[model samples]
Structures are given as C-alpha cells and as structure tokens.
Target chain A: MLRKADTSATWAIAFSTVFFFIGGLLTTVAPPMIDKTWSKPFENNDPSKGPTGKLVNYTPQQLKGRAIYVREGCWYCHTQQTRTLLSDTIRSGWKGVRSPVSTPDEFVYDYPHMFGTKRTGPDLSRVGGKYDTQWHRTHFRNPRDLVQGSIMPPFPWIVEDKEEFESLVAYIQTLGRAKNWRPDNDYEK
Target chain B: MPEQTSGRVALGAGGTVPAIEHCDTTAKWFMISSVSYFFIVGIIALTIAAKFCWPSLLGSVQYLTYGRLRPLHVNGMLFGWLLPADMALTFFIVPRLCAVKLYSEKLGVATAVLWNIIVLGAVVTLPLGMNQGLEYAELPMGLDILVVIAWLMFSYNIFATIFARKYEAMYVSLWYIMGTLVWTAFVYLTGNFAVLFATGTNQANLNWMYVHNAVGLIFTPVGLAIAYYYIPKSSNTPIYSHRLSMIGFWALAFVYVWTGAHHMIHGPISQWLQTISIAFSVMLLIPVWAAVYNFFATMKGQWHQLRESVPLKFLMSGVVFYLLTCFQGPMHSLRSVNAIVSKTDWIPGHAHMALLGAFSFFAIAGIYFTLPRLFQRKLFSEVLANWSYWFLMIGGLGFFVTLWLGGFWQGWQWNNPAIPFIDTVKALQPIWLVRFFSGVLMFAGIVSFVYNVMATILGQARDEAQTV
Candidate 1:
C-alpha cells in the first residue's frame, strides 16, 4: 500500500541505521579483542636499559633534529621498529655483524610501535647507527642523490633551518633505542 | 507469417521506425571491445594472485614479486577494465539523457581507442618495473603522461557536449558527471606534478591525496551518477528526494579531500595532521550516509523490479557494499585502531569492497540497463545475469570477511613483543587459504558475467526484442 518514493526513503533510513550501528559496535569492541590476542608475555622488558639505549645519550642538537622529522611527515614513509624474526630482522638490518636483535624483555615500554607500512624508501628503524649525520643530512636533502632508484621526496628545506634540523635528528635517534640500549656506545657523540 | 507482416505494416505505417540500426551496430562493437578488455585484465590479475599463492610459479623475476604485481593488478582493474567500461556508459548515457545524438561519434571512438593504448602502456611499463614507486602512481612517468593526455581529450569531448545541451536545467546526474571530469583533471595534474616531476618530500603527501581523490572524485561520482539515473528510470518513478542528492554531492566534494592523511595515522606525521585527517574522515560519514539513505529510499517499494531486472539487482547490491566500505574506512582512520590494522590486508579488504563491490557493480548495472536501448536487443540470458549477481555478491562478501579478519590477526600479533612474526604468519596461513578460495569464487563470478555480456552483444537477433 506504500507509495514507491516512501518505500525507498524508508529502506534508505533502515539500511543506514543498521550500518551505523554495526560500525559503532565494531569500533567499541575491536581494541579489546586485539589486546587479548596480541599482548606479549615479556615481564622484564625496558627499552632504555638495552644496548640501543645509547640513543639516550643524544646531544641537544640530535634531539632537536628528531623533533623536526616528526613535524615534516617523514614518518609517513619511514618506520622505526623491527621485529625479532630472523628473516625480517636480517633484511631490514636489525641483525648481522652490523646490528643485532634485542631481547623480548627490551621492548615492553614502547607506547605505540612506529613501524610504518609502504616502504617508499628503505627502513629507518636502525638508521641512527647505520648512516653518519652528514649522510643523513644529504639524504634528507635529496634522497635521489645517494640512491638513484629512491622514490623518497627530498627534505632539502629541513636543512635550511638549523634549529629544526637538530630536532629531527634527535627524534630519529630515539626510534630504535631498545636494540642499542648499551650506555657507553655514545650514539650522538 | 502473413498476419504478423500485416500487423508490422500497420504499425510501421505510422512512422518509419527511424533507422537507429547504425547506432546499434556501433554500440555493440563498443560493448564487445570493452567486455573483452575486462576479461583479459581480470584473468591476468587472477594469475598474478595465484603466483602469490605459489611463488615458484613466477620463476626468478623480481618484476613478478608481490610488491610489483600488486600495483599491476590494481591498475589493470582500475584503469584497464573499469575505466573503459565506465567511459562507454558515459558515451551512451549523456547523449540519451540530453535528448540528442552524441556531438561527435568520431571523438567517442577516438577516446575508446586511446583508452586501450594507455592501458597497453601500463602493461609494458609495469612489468619492466620502471615505476615511480608511489602507490597508484606506479605507472612509469611516460605512461602517466599518455593517460593524462587521453583524459584531457575525453574531458574536452564531454564538456563540449554539456555546453551544447538543449535542456535549460542540468539534471542531477549531469552535475555528477561534469564534476568528476573537471575535478579529476585538476587533481591528476597537481598530484602527479609534471612540473615538480618527482622532486620534493611533498611526493608522499601528494601521492595519498591524489589516490584518495581518484576514489572520491572520479570513481565515486561516476558510479553514483549511474545509480541515480538508472534506479529511478528502471523503477518507473522520480527519485525519492532531489534535495538530499544535492546535499550529499556537495558535502562529499568538500569533506573527502581532507581525509588522505588518515592513512598516516600513528606514523611520524605531525599530531595535528593525523588528528585533522581523522576528524574529517569521521565527518565524511554524514555525506556518505546521506547518499546511502537516498539510494535505498529510492528503491524502497520497488522490490519487484529487483526480482525481474538484472540492472536493479547489481545496483542495489552495490549500494549495500558502499555503506560497508565507508564505515570501515573511518574506523580504520582512528589512531587507536589504526595502530593495529595499518599496512595490513584489512586496508585492501576495504579498498576492494569499495572498488569491486560498490563501483564495479553499479558500473555493470549501468551497462546492462543501457544495452537494450543502445543495441536494440534483449539480453542473451537473464538467468546467467542472475547467476553472475549472486556469484559476485557472495564471493565478494567472503573475500572481505576473510581478509579483514586475517589482517586484524596479523596486526595484533605483529605488535606484541612476545609473539614472533613467523608465528603470526603461521597463524594466518589458514586465513590466506580462505582468501584463495574466496578469490576463486570471485574470479568465476567475473568470468560468468563477462561471458553473459559477450553473448548478448554477439548472439543472433531475437524474433521479438525487449524494450527497456
């Protein structure tokens, strides 16, 4: 007995209401499920106490550079975390003669894993120990200069401002502190 | 036979059954070419996916890795198959809607041929791995230029036709079509940056912005326009509400662009950037929900048409999935939530649900609805059309659920310092198997639809053609 237009309007309202309810319900419930399934069992984990904690020794200049990195959206393309699994750790330089994996107890204090997706460029989780400050500066200025095939857009302007540059370096060094927690390594000396 | 001839003669005496036969032939050729293109690209994508399931199938070529092939499959679907067919529908619909013949048949044919050439360029460059490495901008710079040129030509032809309009008030559907064309051209040019040509860190921000707009401005508008036109026409009624349509259209145009940064949630981006992205994404629910409401409301009482009309079946089902994708998209944008699901198959599940489930379904419906009128013939088999609908619908649902669940599981395990990454992959092996099965079902559905479309265009003329 309903007119066609009325029927359509009613259907639209019903469908939208149903989906809205479903979406809201899922958001409310998803986090707990994630925690239940994924929470790690490491009790003694504290990233600052590990060998990579050498980053804690960063100078004021390096710390300043790190802050700038965060401000410029560089994290959108780069990740600062590595899994302990052999394949990923090896491929991303988290393990080898150059870099070794941190123990399970090392990572518990981390708030949000800064591991990024979309490797628009190489992984930056261990970049603090891998490249010198000058190299980092040049690469940030124009990535293509160092790596011919790199698709990373140059952050040349990051260098133009000395204060901002220092903050960004400081931020980048903090990324993998758990893996390099040893105190005497002098990460930013 | 004599009685039938006498009846036909009597009816024909009134008017000479205007010779639209030439239009019919050309339209058939266009449909056949486009559908074949769809089948070819679909099969290639399936094969690439299969290669992922069994890596040995790809031999030792770096070009065949999951990273490269993923972009190729996506591009093939978005550009090769979907875009061509949508263009064909536009060519057919714009003329009829305006109550005039297409302004230039030659231009239309030229656009169709250029589309194939651009897709061919993708085929050549992508396998060579000569990419810009930006997601959705993987087509090499040279090929990207070719595509831009083709789009410019197509936009020119469409706008010229619009300028030549005889109707005083532009219909809602025309607004959507014109907006999509103009907005896409501007976004494509700026985002790709032929001027900057891959220089600044702006590339990251620019890439996501362009790709998201491609979804919002280009595909979403075109799909909605087709739905608006066909749903009302097929149901033999005016749309449920014109004002709601205008509101949905404008709100979407304004709000959707600001949402690209949601993809960067929890990353090293500025806190404000991520925050604003999340805010706008959540706000997007307003316009999206309004559009969903309009679509369902328009179809409310017309359940009978859904049962009998193949086009209606595809269109209504598409609307259902569009609501699902938009809601999921905003949820994934939230930082707390994205902390777990970012960079996982969950993202692809949402993407496919939007592109395959929503846009492609509406597109197929538009094509099916226009076929009889354009070609002057009945579908080769309504039963096959019904089968295709159910196959795609069920298969797509299966694909979405399995991938989303698997991605969630992977995200959780990867973030847990106690859980080994290998263990997470081990846990997900079962889910990936489910994905393969669901993918098989989807592939079968696409093949069946392609076959049905081909038969309709190529089969011998029926004794009594069905009117649209």
Candidate 2:
C-alpha cells in the first residue's frame, strides 16, 4: 500500500521547525534592553575581605573534588550564588547580609555562576563560614546524619580518602566569598 | 469469538491487524488495580488541597502540612496515577504495533506489582514526613530502590518485545516508547546517584535534570507517540511526514536535556551555563512547535472526528495544551521572566498544564481508544465518557487560568519590597478558591472516567457492538 505525505503535515513540520530555529536564534541575540531590565538595584559584597580570606585558593585535591562535581553534574543542584535580599536570606538563614540585592560585579573574576535553581537542597552560595572541613567531609559522606530529612544521596566515595576530603572541603569553602562573616552591627549586638 | 479469530488470522498473514491478541491478563489486572489505587490517592490529594484552600475544613496535622502534602499530591499524580496508566498502555501498544506478543507477561505483572508497592511506600512514608524533600524525587531511598527495580524490569520487557517483533519498519510510536524506556533508565540512574547524595548540591541539579527529562524524554514522548499513532489510525490516513517525525524526535532529544537549566534562571550557577540553558530552552520551540504543527495539520480536514470521538476529544485537547505549555515554558525560562515567577505557583501552573493537561489527557485518550479493542467489548457508555471529557476540560481550563493569574499576582506582589508575603498570599485567597473548585471538578471527571472504564470492561456487551 502506497501512502502520500499529507500537505497539512508538511506545513506543520515546516512551520514548527522555523519557529524552533527562530526561538533559538532569538536567545543568542541579546534580548531587548527593556526585556532584560531588573526591578531592583544590584548590591555589592566582597568575600575576599571577609573571614573567608582565611582560606584562599585550592589544594590540588580540592580541585579534584570540584572536577568531580562538574563531571557528575553536581552543579545541577547546588547553587553557589545568593541574592542579597531578605526572602532568600531568611530561608537560607543568612538573612540581612546576603540579600538579592547583591550584584554580579562583586565576583568580577568569577566565570559561569554556579547559582543553582530549585531548593531541593539548601543554597550553598554562602558556604565559607557556615561549617568546618570536618562538617563538610562528614556531611558529604552522609547528609542524613546532619539533616535527618535530607533527600541528598550519600557521596562516601568522594570522602573515602583524607586528602580528597580536604580538597573537596577546600572547594566548597570557595563557593560564597562575599558573606563569610556577619556584619559588624550584628557582632556588636 | 469471530473478532478474536480474525485478529489472529490477521497476525498469521502478517497483514495489518486492527488489534492483536492481548496476552497477559494478569498484567491487565495489575494495571486495573494500580489505577484504582491511584484514583483513591488522587481524590485524597484533591481533598487535602481543597482543605488547604479552605483551611477551616481540616485542622492542621504535621503529616498533612502544606509542605509535606504538596509533594505527596504531585508524586501520587505522577507516579501512582499517570505512570501505571502509561506502563499499561506501553504493554498493550508495543505488542500490537510490533505484531508480536509481550516477551514475558509474568515480568510485566511483576513490574506493575513492584510499581504499586513503590508508590504505596511513598504514600505511607511521605505523610510521616520521612521524605527526601526533593520535588518529584521525594520518595526516600528505600522506596527509590523499589522504583529502580520496577524500571529495570520494564526496560527489559520492552526491549525483549522490540527484539521479538515481526515488523521490518518500526513505527514512530515504537521508537518513542523504546526511547522513553531506555532514556529514563539512564536519566533516573544519573539523577539519583549514590555518590552525590550527601553533597546536597547534587540534589538540585539532579532533581531539575530528572524532573525536566521526566517530562521531556519520558512522559512527553510517550504521550506524543500515542498521539502520533492514534491520530493517524483513527483518521484512517498515514502520517503526513515520516521525515518530520524523525527530525522532531532527534531535535527534541538533543535540546531538552540542555534546557533543564533554564529552570535555574538568575541562579548562582555560571552565567555561561544559564545563557546556554536559556538558548537551548528557547530552541525547544522548534521540536515542540513541530509536534504541534504535525498534530494540528494531521487533523486539517478530519476536524469532525473531534466532535464525534471521545478519544479525539482528549487527543486534540491535549495537543492544544501541549502548544500552550511549550509557549509558556520558554517564556518562563527567560531570565527577566524568571526573576518574577520563580518559586511561586507559576511553576505549578506550568507543570499542571503540561503533565495533567497535555500528557494525562493524551494517555487517557489512548487507553480509551485501545481498551475496547483489546477487551472485545463496547465502551460502557458514550454519555459517561463525554461527561468526563467536559468535566475535565472545563476544570482543567479553569485551573490553567486561575493558577496562571494567581502565579503572576504572587510574583508581582513578592517582587515588591513594599508588599509583605502574608498579604500577597491573602490576595491569592480568591484565586485559590477557584483552583480548589476546579480541582474538585477534575476529581469528579477522573471518577467518572474510572467508572466508565470499569463498567465497560465488566458490563454485558451489546449485540451489535462496533469495533473500537
């Protein structure tokens, strides 16, 4: 039995294909300035001057942990950027200092922001002063011990070696440089 | 049994059979049992949501907290309700399409049973607040094992059937079904990696990847496969363009995975990654629009079928929603757009529009179209089917509007530093009321559909029954 291609189907295919290409093309071309405008002003916070300065640069092993994270798609989940705003700060327990008002210029040297989407896990944008290397290592080995309701899978393999564990901790420590220490007002209080 | 005998003869002659002999009565029974469980679970979720919209109706319990129960509601619909139906349809459709019997009925039934256990385990565990806290991936580790085993079993059965098929040119539906099964296996495994579980960072990326792919690679493809087959089969015409189907399929597969990051717009991830995600997400318009065009074009002159056939009603309505969902999805992915709507009801509105509106509707239509032919019975009542369609249609439309508008309102209000969150939620009270009412209508529609399906299967057949 011979079958003829329907005209309607042909046209549908042509139209949709054209639309897909156009949509893709439009994204590459800078969106109109008005379309890219933000409602709020960006804030600036520098982490290098904060307590996070206590741990700058990575050991080779920590670099490996970062490599593992990228290779295994860990960035798919944890975001390293925090908005300098109240709502996110409140939810993340970093309210007041780490608001959405924070601007990208604060991290002028940083390439591809690791700010993640979805809150399946807590934001890691301000990891510098939150926990110690041991906490980071133990949590990486088994998050359930730290948070009973954590849905995060265990990464025992990453922490199996002490050197690797230190490196991984070092990498995580580099995540949020700007808000590693509480503001002076809070400390004075 | 003349119809059965003719079907067998068609199979023997290698002629195109209107239907094939459905082996595995046990699998069918398991599917029915799962569907029943899903219906009950669906109603319970709807009731909970109803109470949430009107909190006075039910006092608070930790187990039924909005945070806990919302995930339950979503999981039940996706896993308990839709997954089983899609699996059953796969078992039925693949064999007929391939001119072969399922490789093993026992394996099929085992998969169904395990799937039910896994979903039930989630229902039991989640209410206790023992969840993984991941949206859609909320099932705890123990239950995740069961789901993984069930998926492996399904993958094996589907592959075995494909290998055993007699057909030379595999139909488009077969490609989609096979793709869904194979890709899901990889997608699920990667998304739920044992290594990344502790870092917590992996969870977000994995969850977004899994959730997005679950829609794009798994549910969307299966739903579209059914549409591709049923639309042409019902119209008694070959598809308009085989080449387009191939192109659309490849484009969709390539683009969808990269697009998941779009959900993370303005996220702390690298600017390059976000830009890439947005670009690919916008690019998705090609494959998606291609599908929409193909579907609409196929129905160009056969528009009358939409009026007469309940299956067509579901299918066409589903196609329309698919277009709407894709359009809205890319729009939401835009960074400026995400700044307003992220973490709000807007996301759920998109989800419902795609999952419930597009995929679920198409899945039901496929089941409705295939059930009678497989069972050798007339549909119990056209009237009940029509009523169910209208109920769901009206209810779904109402849900889309109210949620979309409510989401925008919430986004606008939350974005304003001057406006407080509590007052924004308060402002949404009326819209939430509409959502609850619409949900109730949808619940009624689901019950009606279940009733129609069950009665048709068990009820006495008419003397002059027409072939489905």
Candidate 3:
C-alpha cells in the first residue's frame, strides 16, 4: 500500500467525495427513504402503537406563534423531542401516560425541525395543553415569578404584544398534540 | 508555465501593482476583519454569559432577550470570527506553499467584505426577531443563499489558484484546504436547501447533519491543516511522518461526515443512522490521535522551543485540546454517556474546547505568525501576546470545567424522579457565574489581541516613516 511515494490529488479528492457523499446519503438522504417506506406500514398496521400517520397542521394563529417561537429562539433552552430514554420520557410524558417515542410522521410538516440540541429548561414536547393560557402568560412575562431560580429572562415585551403572546401560546399548545397524543386527547373525551 | 510567467511579467510592465500577484493584502484584510469580529463577538458572548448569572442584565429590551442574544453570539462567532480567520490563513498558506500568486486577490477581498456584511445581517436579523429557528443553520432562507454564493465564489477563487500552482507534489495542507472548501459547500447547501423539501424525521436528520458537519468538516479540517503547516514551521523541522499525515487526512475525511447523526442518537432518527454515527465517532479517534502524535513527534528535539515560540506554544496546546475534544466526542456519542450529557450544558462545554481551545487558538497563532510578514515588522509587545495567550488558555480551561460540571449536575438531578426541574436550574447558578467570569477573561484576551495587532501594524508604519 505504501509502494507509491506519490498519490494523485485526483485520487485523493475522488476518494473523499465518494465516501463522504455516501455517508451523507446514508444519513441525511437515506433516512427520508426509510421514513417513506416504513411510515405507510406503520400507519396502516399500528396507528395506535407507533407514529401518527399524518401531522395535524397548525392553524394560522398557531403558525404565527410558531414563527414567534423561532424568532425568540425558545428552542435553545427547551427541546421539543422527547427521546426514548427514561430521563427524557419520564419528564416529558403526559400525565399518567408514558411519553410516546417521537416518530418521523409527527414532524411531517416541520420545515426546520425544532428537535433542539439542549435542555437548559425542560423538554417542551408535551408542554401543549399541560398548562392553561394564563400560566403561559404569567410565565413568559417573568419566568422567575412562577419558578424560583429560573435563569430564563423575562419576555414582558411579548406579554404586552397580544398577537405575538397568544401566537406563541397557540404554538406551545400544539407540541405533543401535533400527532400521536391527539388521539389520546380524543380518547379521553 | 508560459501563462504563469507572462502574468508576472505583465504585472511588472504596468505601473499599477497586480492585484492577483500576491495574497498579502487580501489575507491581511481578512486577518484584520477576523480579529475585529473576534473582539466584537467575544463581547456578545460575554453578554449572554452574563445573562446566565444575571438574567436582568439587559432584560428590559425586547432585542436583548437571552434567546435572541444567544444566537447572535453563536452565529457571530461562527460566521464572523472563526470562519474568516480560517479563510485568512488559507489564503496566506495557499500561495506560499504553491510558490505562486493567488488567482484573484481582489476576489478574496470582495469575499471578505461580503462575508462581513452577511455576518452583520445575522447580527441585525436575529435580534430583530427574524430567524428560521434551526441551530447553526439559523440564518433565514434569504441570507442562506448569500452564504452559499459566498462560498461558491471563494471555492472558485481557491480552486483557480490551486490550478495555477507552480509546485508539483501536493502537500497535506492542500488536501485539507481543498477538502474544507468542497465539503463546506456540500454541507451548507444540503443543510439549508434540502431542509426545505424534508419534513419531520428527515428534517431532524438533515439539521443535525449540517450542525455537526459545520464544525467537523469545515472548522475541524481547516484547523488541522493550519496545525500541520505551522507546527513544523515553528519547530524548524520537517514533519515526523508524511505517511501518518496521509493516514490522518484520509481517515478523517471518510469518518467525520458519518458521525453527525450522533447528535440525533436516541431521538426519532432511525437506529441504523445512530449506529453509523456512533461507529464512525469511535473510529474518529484514530485520525485525531494520529494527527496529534505527528505534531508532538515532530517536536522531538524542539520541545524547548515551546517556551520561546508563541505560535508553537499555541499550536501544540491547541493540538492537545483537539485530542481531548475528539476523545470526549467519541465517549459522549456512546449511548450511555449520551443519555447523561446529550442535552446538558456539557455539549456547549465540548463545543467551546473545540472552537475556542482548538481552532481559535490555531487562528490566533496564525495571526501572530503572519502579521509580521504582512506588516514587515515584529510584534509590538511580546508581553501582551503572552498575556492574551494565558487569558485564553485559563479562560477556555475554566469554562470547560465549570460547564462540564454544571451539565453533569443538571443531568444527574433531572434524571431523578423526585427532583423538580427548578432545583436543577438553581443548582447551576454558581457554575454559571464562574462561566461568565471565564467568558469575561476570554473577552479581555480578544481585546489584548486586537490592541496588539493594531500596534504591530502601526509600529511598522512608524518605523518606515522614520527611515524615510
């Protein structure tokens, strides 16, 4: 293998491109394919068990609030994905229900995918409907007012802006209910 | 060959200096701009760090909210400071190694100007509540296009210069440089554009891919390339093993792209992708250590030079940090460890060591080495440089330790069924304050850096005027 003292730049570039491209395809490109393939069967056979087949589209107000969430960078401190681990599931699960493992279809409509990297605060996947609009209002206006020692900065400006405040509330309320747990809400009713 | 000679000759014939004949001015502009960004972004980071301990520091302003400020700090550092500094060194390195001029010096300068504008755009837009909400790829679609185009122009300029090179045997640094340019284009485009088409799990996959590759492919490779070039230069020796370098380069390029999905481990991403990410992350240790060993081994008899040469000191310590980062990276990707630290402050701690400790250290060292050549004078004060160096080293190390401990504490407390979330937040307050002060020290280091650089250039001008 070391016989040749000189390696071609062409060969080096070609080797890297091929492998990296394959890796990219395998991870980023291929997963969607896996989703498309597995999604239908999971939808038909195990709708109650696995993923909710279709994502519930956000209303106009919810979309506006979603935009506000993006604007505010809320995802930096709060993660939306409740992973399968006990630590994540236990905290993020709905009352008396184990947290459903987040599935591909649940995010079918999410463009930027807000499955955040950190959890400086708690996971927000099941935060929707857990608290009333008033709690969210008070909390956003000043986090430490409700939760002692919270490092989250006050969003009093948002509280004053009714549209943005309600919009963010609407968006927050759609988190876990976007797909899998909507059925649970329906079942409970 | 004739074209190369004719280009040089043509420049000599004209009274106006050939803009493409050398890279000094363009590289210097990038270096200066990069250093300025370093100081500016360091302050923004300090503000965010302060907000951690004192949430009301600027809590009244809508724009000064922690959410907005955090992204500004992150994007400002990534796009403004680190990337441009890498570009500056790349421009400087390419010409000297090839024994030829830059393909277009004006193009390089234009790219730097546009890049600064783009960074400024991020600074304004993020705070103005105009963001796309994806981490790392947070720039909105409009600005995302600008980034792609900038890189396109940059890649074109770089490749054209590589094509016009007078040297025959391609060095290892050239390979890394080319890899960075090409891979960044691929990563940036796919990360931003492909997400528009993808939804749900696919989007998550793509986003993490972009996020991880931004550091692993672009910053990591570029950083390694600088270390490869400078370590031997500063040590006054040839590389210990070319074979080892070759092994490192190939292994790194093949391994790193696959490792991005580790960010999505235990999440909704397919299990196989997680497995691929974990496997490759562990495999990454080989290339990482290989490069580290090569750097240290090259310093066999020259270990004493670390005391005298500031650049070598920075570069060697940067290598050690890189080694630690890579070690921590593979270990964290393990499912067990990932469970504990995946969403903790620990991730940011790991990131700081890589960005501040490894690459930014290399960038600082490169600036110290190149400024004299660009300005035709020695640094104005060795004391300031040493001071800045110690500040960065201590600040970086302290930040890493505090954040790692805080992350662990938060993760452990959160894992307990009985502990409320507020308890975890309260527990980390002291650590967060330490992080803020450490960040302030890092900010001070950048201030020293800017002052020293300006003085070095100004001192050269003064000396020339006196001689005249």
Candidate 4:
C-alpha cells in the first residue's frame, strides 16, 4: 500500500509541475516574445517614442521623486495603468477628449511595473498637467483641505522637505503626456 | 533529516521532547508563536482599518504611514500567523497519521526560529521604507532568500517523515500536505525570480500569479489538509467517500495554477491570456465543491458533535467559509464583474473571508483538538471558546458584507467620471469605521481564544508537575 501511494505522490508532483510550467510559459513567457499577438517593447529605452503618445524620459529630480513614490507605496491606492475601457479613458482624462489606454511600450523604463492592483484614489495614469506644482504641494500637506472629504492621509513631510516635494511633483507631472497632447491636440488626431 | 532513533523518540539528539512524548516541542512552539502573531497582526490590522476612516489618527510618521503598515499587516498575517500556524499543525498531525515520528524536531525548531527572523526583518524594514514593492512578495531580496532556506528546511523535515511512515496507504490529508510542499516552492521561486527576468506586463502577470498562488498553493491546501484530518476525527465519523477525495485533490491541483492571471482581466494583457485565466478560474468550483461535499457528507448524522466538540465547531465553520469564498472567487473573475469590483474594497473583503474566515478557523480547530491531548487537559473554558467563535463569526460577517457594499458603491462611482472622487471617499468613511469595529471584535475573539488555550496548557503542566 505504501509503494502504491509513493507512485501516487510522484504522479501528483509530476502533474502539478507540468501545469505550472505550461501556465507560466503561456502567460509570462509567450506574450513578450510573440509581439504580433501582444506588444513590442520600446527600443532605445525611450518612453518618448512610445506608440500611442510621445512621453519624455523623467528628469533626474523626477526620478528621485519616483523612488519616494515607490517607497511610500503610493501605488497601493493610485493605479498607474489606464485600461482600454471607456470608463477608464474618460475618467482618467479631464476634458471630453479620450485618454489613450496604457500600453506596455509606455512602461518600457518601468523596471518593476507599477500597474497597481487597487484604485482607492482616482487613476493617475494621465495626471500630468492636471494640476500645477503648488496645488500638489498643498494637497499632499492636507488632502482634505483642498478636496473636501478626501480620505488621503496628510504627508506634511512632502511639503517641508524641498527635494521630496519638488521631485515627487516633477515625476507625477510626467504621467501619460504626449508631446503636444493637451496643447496642439491635432498631432494625435 | 535523520530518522528517529527509536519508536518512542520523536527525534534524534538536540530536541527537548515535550513532557508527553507524543506532543512535539517544535509544534508547540510554532503554535504558540502563530497564536501570538495572530493577536499582534489583529492589532496591526485594526490600526490600518482605523486609518482608513480616521486618516490622521496615527500621525504622519514615515514608518507608520499607510503604505508601510499595509504591507507589514499583510506580511504579519501571512508569514507571522497563517504559515506558522499551518506548519505547527502539520508537525503535530502528520506523524500520527503516518504512524511514525517527525524526522527531526531540532530542524523543525530551527526553521521556526529562522521564520521568525524573516518576519522580524520584514516588520522592521518595511516600516523603514525598504521593500521590493510587490504585493505578498514584498520582502527584500536578502530576506526572500532566507525564506527559501527556511521553507527548504521545513519541507525536508516533512518529506523525511512521510518517507519513513509505517502506514502503507496514505490518507487524503497526507496527499494534500505533500501537494502543498511541492506547490508552494514552485510558486514562490517563480514569483520571486520573475521580477529579475520578466519586465512590464509580464512582470504584472507574474506578480499577480504570485499573489494569487501564495494563497492557493500554501494556505488553501494546508487548510484543507488539516480539515480533511480534523473534521472527521473530531466529529467521530468515517470519511464519506474516498473516491470523492481523490477527485477533489486531482481537480484542485489541475485548475488552481492557471487561474492566477484572472486578476489581470480587462487590464493590459493578451486577450487570450485573460480568457484562459477566467476559464480556469471557473473550473476551480469543481474541486471546491467536491471537497466541501465530502466534508459535509462525512458529518451526516453528527450534528450534535458540532455543538459538543469545540474543534468540530471551528472546522465546520471553516468548511462553510471555504465554500463561500471559492464561489465569490469565480464570480468576481468574470469580465463584467471584474470591471466593476477588481480593485475595490471587495477584493480585500474576499481575501479576509478566505484567510481569516476559512483558514484561520481551520488552524484554530486543529490547535484546539491537538493541544489538549498533548498537554493532557480539558479546554480551559468551553464558554470562552464559544464566545470567541460568536465574536469572530459576527465580526467576520459584518466586515465582509460592509466592504462588499462599499466596493460596489465605490466601483460604480469611479466608473462615472462626472461624480467627484471625494464623494466616494466620504461614503467609504462610514464603512471603514464599521470595518475597524469589526476588526476590534475579531481581536477580542483572538484574545479570548489565545487566553483559553494558554491557561489550559499552563494549568495542565502545573498538574503534571504536582503529581510528579
């Protein structure tokens, strides 16, 4: 009976391994390699040349802010990716005009992808140019003061520390902006 | 792992075996650690839930920020509590089932110590803003390696015991345990390593895979393993059908791994990948129902046992939660439902229903059943045990239902861009308060349960000492 059970154990091991491999390969491995079915990564490590919009690379200051963003886990509440659906496109966009869906190419430089799982706050995919630098500084200090009933916790440190404030605002201002997306909109058209 | 020196000895040298030869020291330590952590994690969770309603309550200290505490809360609950709880139960239950002793109690204890170190590192560093930024896989690279080592040690001990078993035909519970040993390692390595090699959407896919599978492979199977054992044993009944157990085991192994990508539905991914995930996710029902059916069927005429037997009460409640959680899983994975509720408060509600509701109950039941026999004492207080149960049941139910309603409300509000986002936050404030209070009730239950167990064991030890 033990010998028979050993064989069953081996069978269990083999069955699960095979399935894990197949599932992982098809989902994680196959998609990037098969560009026709999915998406091709951006070449020259340039977000500015992404397919949907021209996104400039982050300044060094903005990169510093990006690190702070990651450290603070801003991604827990705010999602970076805007989906293809109308709700996401319009919701992320300020005016009647549609925001382009977040594609893999736009995230080429994103080493550890921050396509966050939750959206307690509104999606920040196209938050670039939505508010000026001063607005962000005050909002971070006391979120509820600017936006009544906002449940976001105050980050007074962001206001007090110059580097943390400037860099974070700089990085956020670069989210999902095309070369002339809001200015000369005819480029996208 | 060295085989036992003799039948009476649970391990070779280096183990201070318990006063009762049958009860392993490592199991006791792990159980005590798990219970203590469960209580600690509850406080952590309550703080976070409090911050959700009263955002400024904890102040703007960097270490105590929402993001840092959120990950710590998660890691504490998973590693500090559930994983060790399951490990402790495995140590106690497996040897008896196999008609053998543990491979090495020293190794088991060492692994438990290392596991604590790993969690401690996470608790400290996460607050200091040191993290890998992945949900569930947030431990930095160094600690992650330590985890792999700790897992290896525990697995070696467990597998060695199974190999040395005198019992020829392995029971259903043993099968589940063996499956978890293999699946957790595979899922962990893949999830952790994927960040190094994979990038962009592939990383996202792998991340969610890790997130989903961490529970599916680790907690779910172990919870079921203990359930398969304790439910029948505590209820004083034979298993309903051996064939059904086989079907359930094989089906769960087949369906669970592929469904991780369901978390990425309507997000940027290949359409086929999303399709495959949803397809496999729905198939999860087969295994869930099959196992649930067998458990219920086993208790056919044992209704009174559920009332009399404390372990049976928790195990039955666990089985019911398992059924509800699995049903919720597949329903939420659907495209339409995913669009509405994927990233809302609903997902956390679903998660707690699985962990706090189903798995924690199983762990509680296992500890209650095993500890008494080991220490040679009746429970400290049956009334307290029942009290803990009622508190948790009401609290867990209130917590889940409120978040679900809040999730749907927020989801609808977010979809309509015209509605100001602040309105949604304001609405959830009341729900968050309710969640915080529900957590308080759970914390109360945990305190009660832990107190009862500790008193029982300490009293039993004192009695034994007096007689000796």
State candidate 4's TM-score: 0.92
- Model 2, B196-292: lDDT tens per residue? 4322322344556666877887798788888898888777667877777877776776687776556656653345657877888898899888888
Query: Looking at model 1, how many pairs of residues clash?
Result: 32
Candidate 4 residues A1-189, lDDT tens each? Answer: 223443344555666566667766776677668754233443343447533344456678878888888888888999987886778888776567777677666665565677898888888878877888888988999998898877788899878999899889888887776423454443220
Q: In order, what are the TM-scores of chain A for the candidates?
A: 0.58, 0.60, 0.82, 0.82
Q: State each model's CA lDDT, in order.
A: 0.63, 0.66, 0.81, 0.81
Q: Deviation in angstroms for B37 in model 3?
A: 0.5
The number of residue pairs in model 2 that clash at the backbone is 31
Residues B117-158, model 1: lDDT tens digits: 777888777665555545566676777787788788777766
Per-residue lDDT of candidate 4, residues B1-468 (tens digit): 333334332323343433324548889889888888888878888888888888887766978988889999999999999999999999988888766688899999999899889988988899898877777888889999999999999988988987676554568888889889888998898778766676567778778888898898889999999999999889878899888988888788778888877887887777777888899899999999999999999999887887777788889999999999999999988998888898899988999999999999999999988887867777777777888888898899999999999999888887887787778788888888898899899888899998878888787444432332
Which is superior by DockQ, 1 or 4?
A: 4
Each candidate's DockQ: 0.04, 0.06, 0.62, 0.53
lDDT of 2: 0.66
Q: Please, what are the lDDT tens digits per residue for candidate 3 over residues A30-101?
A: 766665732331243466565454456788998888888888888898888878788667777666467677
For all predictions in the order shown, the interface RMSD in Å is 14.6, 12.1, 2.1, 2.2
Cα lDDT tens digits, model 1, A1-189, are: 212212132332233334323432232223223433123422324655434232123466654554344333344345554433443355344323334543223333332223345332345665555456687789777655766534444555566677676667655655555454334554652
Worst 10 residues of 1 chain A by lDDT: A1-10
The TM-scores of all predictions, comma-separated, are 0.71, 0.74, 0.92, 0.92
TM-score ranking, high to low:
3, 4, 2, 1
- Of the native A-B interface contacts, what share survives in model 2? 0.03
> What is candidate 1's DockQ?
0.04
Which stretches in model 2 have alpha-carbon errors above 4 Å?
A1-183, A187-189, B1-20, B24-27, B194-202, B460-468
Q: Score candidate 4 by DockQ.
A: 0.53
Of candidates 3 and 1, the better by TM-score:
3
lDDT of 2 at A120: 29
